[model samples]
Target: MSPQTKSKQRVRDHGEVFTAEREVKAMCDLVKDECDRIDSRFLEPACGNGNFLAEILTRKLATVKKLYKSNPYDYERYAVLAVTSIYGVEILADNAEECRKRLFALWDKEYTAVCKKSANDETREAVRYILSKNILCGNALTLMCVDENQKDTDKPIVFPEWSLLGTKLKRRDFRLDVMLKANDKPKNGQPSLFDVPEEIRKYLSINPVTKEFMAEPICEYPPVHYRKVQENG
Candidate 1:
């Protein structure tokens, strides 16, 4: 089992404690169906070394393997999709970095075995890039990116929404603060999208379907091949 505590200072400073593997598995089992769904999104607010996220990725990839193992193309894309759906915000830079590497290792192990000879470097780099963005080094409480010392920075934590379109992927970046408030009901006297007269941000407008504030992307990029997502940078 992975060590639960890295050091007394981290625990005291950041409340850094990794959940045990057994507990992680047990907790994940409670949401077995979601974990097994390839595109279902899971965000870990206090993700440390990714004990829970790792298990969820394992379950999701297992489903991907079972369904697409015969088709390398489908297997590769779905595996990447699975990685995209898992997100994390860890306060400690080293822990966040470790979490990213650990999750990628877990992903690559399964990916290589299933896709075999068809697996390519571009795809591996794409997964690495996805993990780099998905597992952010930030303060979940402050909803801001953290410095090396784990102190909050001015930059708000932004998460990229990755949507697969056939062989391509579309990405939209949204602020964590905005995302958290997106579902809040419009204040009794406040104007919703329909009530606004002047030009307004689409994301700030009420989502007609959900009757909640829309979580608009701060920045959007055109679709790119899943393997070429890094090209957007």
Candidate 2:
């Protein structure tokens, strides 16, 4: 692993400190089952260089290999699903890019070794596209995308909810701020966010079963074959 701090200045400026590998392992062990599930979703709000996410992906891939090693088609699909389940937000653009490259390298190495003759470029590119969407350069606390200088942008951070339906993948984009707001209720005597003006309230949806207010996706794409998401989704 790289040193915990790139420089003293970075530490002071951004409170950046990379977690050691041993500690990352121990913390993940606390939710070991989730880490092993290929489609289980995980988000690291302050994922500096992806120390924790890397380990979780490694474990999920291992489980995929164990179950699908004999069948290349199954292995490729599940491995891509594993990659799609991981997400992160890093305040620094450089760190966010590094985290994405690091994850892709780790996944590609295992994929190449296992699928060997069966691996194809289309599936690999699909994984790349998923990572591009799943990881973001942003401030998790403010839930806004960040600029190169780490200033919050006027644009709110948006993330796609990716789900697989057999060989097809479905996507829905949600604003981070709206998602957080939907998860909580207004405190006593406070106004409900859904009670806003009609223009903004249009973004909220109701769960038919639970009868609860939920954040409506800003946009959604029809399910497309996993290999064609980047091109057609």
Candidate 3:
């Protein structure tokens, strides 16, 4: 097939053929062995079709089952551990959704097996919850935007916490608390403090700067810490 024609075809349909059993087995075995050797978590950032992830999941689930066979009551925990241990991120929303369904199907199969053997419903639902929580639609290149309109924005980047507050002023700092308090007060018994101070505005801004100029020097104060961590050994 020509490259253009081949590109149009899907490499992985549910009924698509994946031949070469021996080579595939060897590749899977290699992954399984390495995972065992290092005890490292695996991430497939661009898991286009889940060919590798499916195999890895199978081996990992098998390993978990074997390891926890004696204490079958903890089987749900084992399943959760296995599923959460492997992470995948895809840029395409469709692919990400498909990947979630694939993982959930695997979870359901494992869950049914455990529930049937344990004769319980609670464990099965717990497995469902864990699968739902961990398998998310996320882009590796960009953090998935929570805002529907910004779904395609590159790298939904967060400004560093320290950087959120631009710089400390020489006098009293322009704290978010003060800004918010100013914003909360009603207009005109005194001019609302939230109204940009005319003098400060004049000093900080140029004539044609516009509203964007008003927003340029921003600051973020850290969250109010209600509790402190213990430091004693």
Candidate 4:
């Protein structure tokens, strides 16, 4: 069994049980193809210390290293995308913080080895920002993220959707609840969840990063740098 829980009381109160490494790998293998895809999105609603997310990040980074080993520019972009694509919700404050740290460390290890002297501070900061947004401290069941104090906030859990547009990175924020409702349809003749007005859809379809289509992000981070660091290169 994975020795991940903080205490027996936590397990009893939260029903928290960390999955063993072997089992995590076995289960993720069922979706091996997706796991290997560098840009595939994954959400762990009840992530505890990021057992699943960590493995997923490792696999995606491996693909980045394999395909873009020679191109630091492409490697940096895709690696950031890989980190941005993972989402996790842990109710416990400590667990959420630990998960973020663990994931960052995992990424940094591979990044340092591959990029060597070329590592850029700005790029690393961007990754840290992305991880901060991706793994949240909140009640997944209630879809509410907590503040730094660990108190529930009125705001719903929000996540930024990242995309590479030519040489630029585009970000759009969306509510977790709204995204979850994407599949639902009302019986009455009404707009489906996430439906945009026809007039707005025209603009969104062409340029999704427009102000009209984008929602304000609940959290803020340093701007992302798209250029590759040339120190090691």
Per-candidate RMSD, Å:
3.2, 2.4, 16.8, 6.3
RMSD of 1: 3.2
Tens digits of per-residue lDDT for model 2 on 49-87? 989989999999999999999999889988988998999
Residue 172 of model 1 has an lDDT of 96
Model 2 scores worst on lDDT over the 10 consecutive residues at 185-194
Better of 3 and 4 by TM-score: 4
What is the C-alpha lDDT profile of model 4 across 1-233, one tens digit per residue?
A: 34866678888888888998999999999999999998899999989899999999999999999999898777777887788789999988889999999999999888888887787777887778778878988888878887766578887787777766655556666677656543334335343324654422332321133312222343333333444311211
- Candidate 4 segments whose C-alpha is farther than 4 A from its true place: 147-151, 188-224, 227-233
Ranking by lDDT: 1, 2, 4, 3
Q: Give each model's whole-structure lDDT.
A: 0.89, 0.87, 0.45, 0.75
Which window of 10 residues has the lowest lDDT sum in candidate 3?
224-233
Q: Candidate 1 on 1-233: residue-level lDDT in tens?
A: 23889788777888877788889999999999999999999999999988999999999999999999999999999999999999999988888998999999999999899889999999999999999999999988889999998889989898999999999999999888777766666778353665532323444756566566777788999999999999996
Which candidate, 1 or 4, would have the higher TM-score against the true structure? Answer: 1
lDDT comparing candidate 4 with the true structure? 0.75
Model 3 regions lying over 4 Å from their true place: 1-26, 36-39, 117-125, 142-151, 154-233
* Candidate maximizing lDDT: 1
| Winner by lDDT between candidate 4 and candidate 2 | 2
Candidate 4 TM-score, C-alpha based:
0.80
lDDT at 38 for candidate 1?
Answer: 98
